[model samples]
Target: MSNVVVQPTGITAADVLAVARGTAKVVLDPATVAAMATSRAIVDRIEAAGRPVYGVSTGFGALANTFVAPERRAELQHALIRSHAAGVGAPMPREVVRAMMLLRVRSLALGRSGVRPLLAEALVDLLNHDVTPWVPEHGSLGASGDLAPLAHCALVLLGEGWVLGPAGERVPAAEALRGAGLTPVALAAKEGLALINGTDGMLGMLLLAIHDAAHLFTMADVTAALAIEAMLGSERPFLPELHAIRPHPGQAVSAANIHRLLQHSAVMDSHRDDLAHAVQDAYSMRCAPQVAGAARDTLAFVEQVAARELVSVVDNPVVLPDGRVESTGNFHGAPLGFAADFLAIAAAEVGAIAERRVDRLLDVTRSRDLPAFLSPDAGVNSGLMIAQYTAAGIVAENRRLAAPASVDSLPTSGMQEDHVSMGWAATRKLRTVLDNLTSLLAVELLAAVRGLQLRAPLTPSPAGRAAVAALRDAAGEPGPDVFLAPVMEAAREVVRDPALRTAIEREVGTLG
Candidate 1:
C-alpha cells in the first residue's frame, strides 16, 4: 500500500481500514502543518494573555472554576491524562485502537484542536511503526469525547502505558518507543484535552460497521435470491413494472437483483403455468425485497452520517483562526449513537426475514416437495433442522441488541457532563449484530443450496447456480448426516466470502 496523505477532507473508510491493518502509511500534508501552526499560535496567544480557557488555564468538568498557575500548566495537562485513563474491561481489538489513533490524528490535522504538528506526527509514527496501545472497551459514556479510552491512548504517546509491539507482544510503552526509535511527547497547553476529547472511538467503530453493513446488505439480496429459487418461488413480483410503481431505490435495487438472479431458471419456468402450485408464495418469499431493501436504504443513510463525521473536527475548546479560544460541545456522540442504533435495528430485521426463509426451506410441509430439514432421510439425520434453530436464536438476540443505546443516558463527570450518548455501547453491540447477521444469512444459504441440490435435474438461474457451486466447492455438497459444525462453519465462511459474490457477479453482473 502507498502512503495516504492526510487532508482536512476526503479521508475514507477504506483508508481507515488500511491504516489500521498496517498496510498503509499516513503522511501529513504541508497545508495541514500550516493549519496546525496557525491554531497553535492562537493557543499560545491565549495562554500569554493570562485569561482562563476551559482546558488551558482552568480545571475541567465540575472543577472548571479552579485556575492553575502558569508554572504548573504542563503538569495540569499530564495529570488530566493520568486521571482519565482509568477505564476497565477487556482490551479493545487492535484494529479499533489503530483506527482511533488515526482518527485522532486526522481531527488534530484539521487544525481546530490547537495541537502542534509534532503531536500529529507522533500519532502517525505510532501507526507506521505498528505500536498499538491497549485501550479498554468500557468507561466511555460517549460524552466529553470518549475520555477514558482516549486517555489510555494518550498514555502510550507519553510513554507511560502498555503497548502491543510489532511482534504482537505486550510491552511497556517506553520499551516499544525505544525499539521503534521514537520518544515520548511532552504535554503542552490544551494538548491533553486535544488528544482525548473527541468521538474517535465511537466514530471508528461506526465507520467499520457501516462498511460491513454495505457488504452484508448486498449479500442479503444474494442469499434471498438463492432462497427464492430454491423454494421454486416465482419472480413475477420482482418485475420492473411491478416494482417501478412503488419505487424506493433500495426496493427497486433488490427486486431487480432477484429478477436477474432468477432469469432463465428452469425450476421457476416449470412452475410458471402449473395450476397445482400455490398462486402466491409465503410472505418470506414475496416480501424479501421489501425487508432487505429497507435495510439497504438504512445503510445509505448511515453511510451519509459516517461520511459527514469523517470530515468533521470534533473537539472541546476548539481554537479559532482569529486567535480566540472558545468552549464547545461538539464532542457529544449522539449523532453516531442514533445512527448505530438505527443500523442495528435494520440489520436485525434483515436477519429476521432471512431466518423466516430458512424456516420455509426446512419445513417439509412448507418447502414444496423437498424432504424434512432438507435431509436425505428425515428422522435418521437431523439435517439443518437445528441450523434454523441457531439462526432463530441469533435473530432473537439481535432483536434484543437492537434496542437503542442512545436512549439510556447516565450522568457522568460529577453531573457536569449529563445526558451522555451511549454510542460506544451502541456501536459495540452493532458489531455483534452484524456478525450474527452474517451467520444467520449463512444458514439461509446452506438451506437454500440444499433445496436447490434436491431440485437436481432442473437447473437454477445462472447466478444462483454459481453461488451453490462456489459453496459446494468450499464446504462440500450437503448429504444425509455428518459432522454439522464444521460444515455449517464452512458455509458461514462462504456466505461471508467476497469471492462468492464476485463469481456470481461475473456471471450475472453485480447485485444490489
Candidate 2:
C-alpha cells in the first residue's frame, strides 16, 4: 500500500481522497511524533497542577464549570465519548467514514490537540486496516465541530462501538480490533475531547465534492459545445476579444474551450455567411460560458476555503507554546458552511442552463429544423420528450438543494452553542446537487449528440465529432429512440467515464 505521511503541518485535499478511497496508508512523521509529545507534556502538567482546563479537568459545553475528581478523569472522558455518540439515521458510506477518520487523524497530528501519539496512531491503524466506524447520517450542528459523527468514530477506538469488518460487515469494534491484531487504547485527560473536536465530517464531504465537481464542470463545457452545434447557434459570442474585455478568469477559459471546439466545423462554416440562419442565438446557447464560468469561480473560492481548513488546528483548549491551554472557537464550521452553500448555488445554475439547452434541442422550432424531440417519427415514438422532462425534474430538485444551509442555526448543548454553522447539511446537499448536475448534463449530451447526427453530411468540428462518436458508441447511433432509460443511463455513464473527456481532449488539446 502506498503511504501518505502525516505531519503537524497537515496534508492536501488529494491526500485526503487517497486515504478515503483506501488507495493509500497513513503514517505519522517522526517530527510530528516529537511535536505531539511536546504538547502532551503541557496537558500532563496542567492535569498535575489541577488547572480547570476546558476539556481537561472541567466538564464540557454547558457543564464546563463542573469539576471532576482526578481519579474519575478517565471516566469523565469515557462518558463524554459514549454520550456524544448519538448520531441517528442510516450508516454513512464507507468512503465518507474513512474520510472523516483520516481528517480527524490529521487534526490530532497537528499536535495542538494535546492527544498522546498513541491515540493518533490508533486512527492511522483503522485507516490502514480498513476498519471503519459505522457513523450515522445526522446529529452534527456544525459548531464545536461535528460532535456526534466524530464521537462515533472515537467510540470505536475505545472498543465500545460498532465498526465495519474487513469485508464490510458490521461487527463489534473490539472484535474488529482483535481481528486486525490491535487492541483499543484508553483515553487520557484531554484525549476524548481532542478526538471529537474538529470539522472533519463536513470538510471530508467538501473535499470529495470538489474532486467530483472538477470532472463534471469540464464535461459541462464539452456538452455545451455539442449543443451549440446541434442548435446551429452562432459561435461569434465566444470570440476572444468579446471575453477579453470582461477579463473574468474562468470566462476567458470557458470561451476559449467553446471557440476552439467549434473551429473548422463545416456546420458552423456552412452558416457563417448565411443571413437567414444567422440571427443572435438564444441566451442558453450564447451565455453558457458566463454561467459555467461563474460556477468555476465559485468552486475556486470553495477550494481556497478547503485549503485553509486542511492546515488548521480545530480543537478546543489547544495547547500553547508557553505552557498554557487556551479555549478558542476554532472548531466553528461557519467558514465551511458558507463556502459549501455558495458552491451548491453555483452548481445548480450550471445544471439549470444545461437543461434549457436540452429543451431547445428537442423543440423543432428552436432546433434549427431538426425533427421534434429528435425523433424519427414524432408521434409514433414519444422520443426524447420525456428526457427533457427528466432534466427539468432534476433542475427543480437542484434549485431546492441549492438553498444556503449556512443561514440555518439551531441551538444545542443547553443553548450553549446557540449559533451553529449547519455546515454538515450544506456539504450533504452539495453532493446531491453535483449528482443532479451530472444527470442533467447527460440529458443534454444525449439530445445534443442526436442533434449532431441529424445535421448529417455537414460534419461537426473535430472535437464535436469526437464527443459525438464517443456518445454514439455507448448510446448507439441516433436513429429511432428505443429503451430510453437504458440509453439515458448509458449517456450518464459516458458523462462519468474519462473516455469521453479523453476523446475530446485528443482532438482539442485540454479543456479549461
Task: Give the top-scoring candidate (lDDT).
Answer: 2
Residue-by-residue lDDT tens digits, candidate 1, 54-128: 899999999999999999999999999999999887788888898899999889988898889999999999989
- What's each prediction's clash count? 0, 0
lDDT of 2: 0.89
**Error in Å for residue 36 of model 2:** 0.7
- Tell me how candidate 1 scores on lDDT: 0.88
TM-score of 2: 0.98
**Model 2 C-alpha lDDT per residue in residues 1-512, reported as the tens digit of each score:** 68899987998898998998758989999988988999999999999998687889989999999998899898999999999999998788888899999999889888898879999899999999888898988999898989999999999999989987656667999988898888988989999999898899999999999988888988888889999988888889999999999989888888888888888888888888887985788999999899899888889999999999999989998998788899989999999999999999999999999999999899988788989999878887777899999999999999999999989898888988889999999998999999899899999988988888889888988877876777675667656668888888888888888898888788779988
Q: Candidate 2: where is the Cα deviation over 4 Å?
A: 165-169
What is the C-alpha local distance difference test score of each model?
0.88, 0.89
